[model samples]
Target: MSYKNILVTGGCGFIGSHFIHHLLKKYKDINLVNVDLLTYCGNPENVRDIADDSRYNFYKADIGDYNAMSSVLKKHQIDCIVNFAAESDNNKAVSSPVDFARTNALGTAVLLEAARQAGVKRFHHISTCEVFGQLPLKSKSKFSEKSPYNPRTPYNAAKASGDLIAKAYHHTFGLPVTISYCANNYGTHQFPEKVIPVFAIRAIQNDPLPVFKSSGNKREWIHVSDHCSAIDLVLEKGRAGETYNVGTGLEKTVTNIADDVLAILKKPKTLKKIVPDRPGHDSRYLLDSSKMKKLGWKPKIKWHEGLEETLNWYKNNPKWWQPLLSRSNSWK
Candidate 1:
């Protein structure tokens, strides 16, 4: 079923903004309503180019605020909701666990309830691979859809709670819902705080790339565009009350990523420095995305090519990232 009026929470944020742009370009008759709180990472510049489109509208509101979300849904006559709003930073979540719970967990429940009450056609929840916790450094096993939730960080714990709540809403209330857990995403317009952007920017500036102790910590990586495509597929064909994992099946370690970035920029490998690992740091994360693949969705971008394109983006767009440097300090 094709949806006409869609409410995309956190539309001004990285992945949400990209998804909005993709939808606007792909569907001519669809109307999109973007709800974003414009937090530190949510920058208006991300979607400023599409701000004036007749079919697209923007609302400066928090999804956690039930009254605000309700008003927007009613005002827009929304039929479908793609939820991307949450406190997603691991370090920040450790420092402020309450904020994570309030946003990732409580906020999700609030939005789910609102969607149920409004009779929205479908509620798609965007989640993270961290909810399955880490795998042994030398283990070959990957986390599948049936993998038990074993969140290690405050951020993942909160996201896990949100996923469970979404499931509960579907089983208990029969509200149409689908959940997707995705691997680490890297692409253009990403905030400099994330690993890819941070390393890219630091490499370009000849700054030391900080590697956590035991740089062998591995993560599955996927381009933001691929992740968005998977989400769209889930919204269109995914069965209600089902969970799908999305990833490229490619894995790289922290040191390997940093080295690759430096190599792409023709910089010295000596710039890599080992630093203390963050609290509750996971050693590795791997996902088995066979479920999403069976749904006719697969990642298109290879890590090396995507990494170069992303590095070039950061290297060329100084104005977009320069202003955010002061705020990004806290993330470091």
Candidate 2:
């Protein structure tokens, strides 16, 4: 509510679209300018329901385009920029590392520069805990802000680069920046490639669920709505030049997820098909969300309730998720 007009990059994507909806519904006086490239993953249907809202506007443009970014910032009188734009798939990164770097690294730099030129009041960058590398599967260890970057894949390395650039802009240029490394997000409107959706969609069709060889890879899952709430808090109350980890501590293995999907949809356990794991696939990812807790922000979604609702969403919305299945490659 403090910022009258906010620019949300990648607003058509899963998390971004949810955040945009959260902001518009929570703050009546605010205006949102959604900037998205509408890439293979950025579906307009994610936010099409709000297309006619007087406070919402969408612009199709790449985040790396400085001229276009700067123009939109000024044209919308944007006071803050929440960057959610990036090439998010690791499978794609395997064959196209440069493409990942181009958007995740260089594009972030360009957007930060544009924000500097436009004198935005606040700049919040979205990041992943994968930048801190994999943790031992059985250990109690978790990723924190103080952890060093040890990205395993090209996609994560590029995201790590983007995080560094955001910190640099804040320290060197005095940009009011706050970055967040959130846990794995699961909910409706997510591209069908990620583990949860892949299981849900396959289970609905009684198709074989592709489970990575070990299928024991563990990751903390946070409902996308909770992640959006944390972002809202960071934008409003977080200190500049700081990074916060957002997670629910609801860690579960990929096998556990597939099982849950199978049971939820009354499918047989035999639907799980063990597949080869992808390169640079981590064994575990858990975040120490003490910082976000200190800020009085915590996730509210219960795992069973949240996951079931998410799976049911994919079950009911086949038209939206079914078409995108072909775009995904064999990935963990």
Instruction: Score every model by TM-score.
Output: 0.98, 0.98
Backbone clash pairs for candidate 2 read none
Per-residue lDDT of candidate 2, residues 1-332 (tens digit): 77999999999999999999999999999999999998889999999899999999999999999999999999998999999999998888998899889999999999999999999999999999899999999899988899999999999999999999999999999999999999999999999878888888778877899889978889899999999999999988899999999998988998898888898889999999998989989999999999999999979999999988998889889899877777767433
| Candidate 1, run of 10 with poorest lDDT | 323-332
CA RMSD of each candidate after superposition: 1.0, 1.3
Candidate 1: give its CA RMSD in angstroms. 1.0
Cand. 2 TM to true fold: 0.98
| Tens-digit lDDT string for candidate 1 (221-285) | 99999999999999899988999999998899999999899999999999999999999999999
Show pairs that collide, candidate 1: none
Residue-level error in angstroms, candidate 1, position 28? 0.8
Give the lowest summed-lDDT range of ten residues in model 2. Answer: 323-332
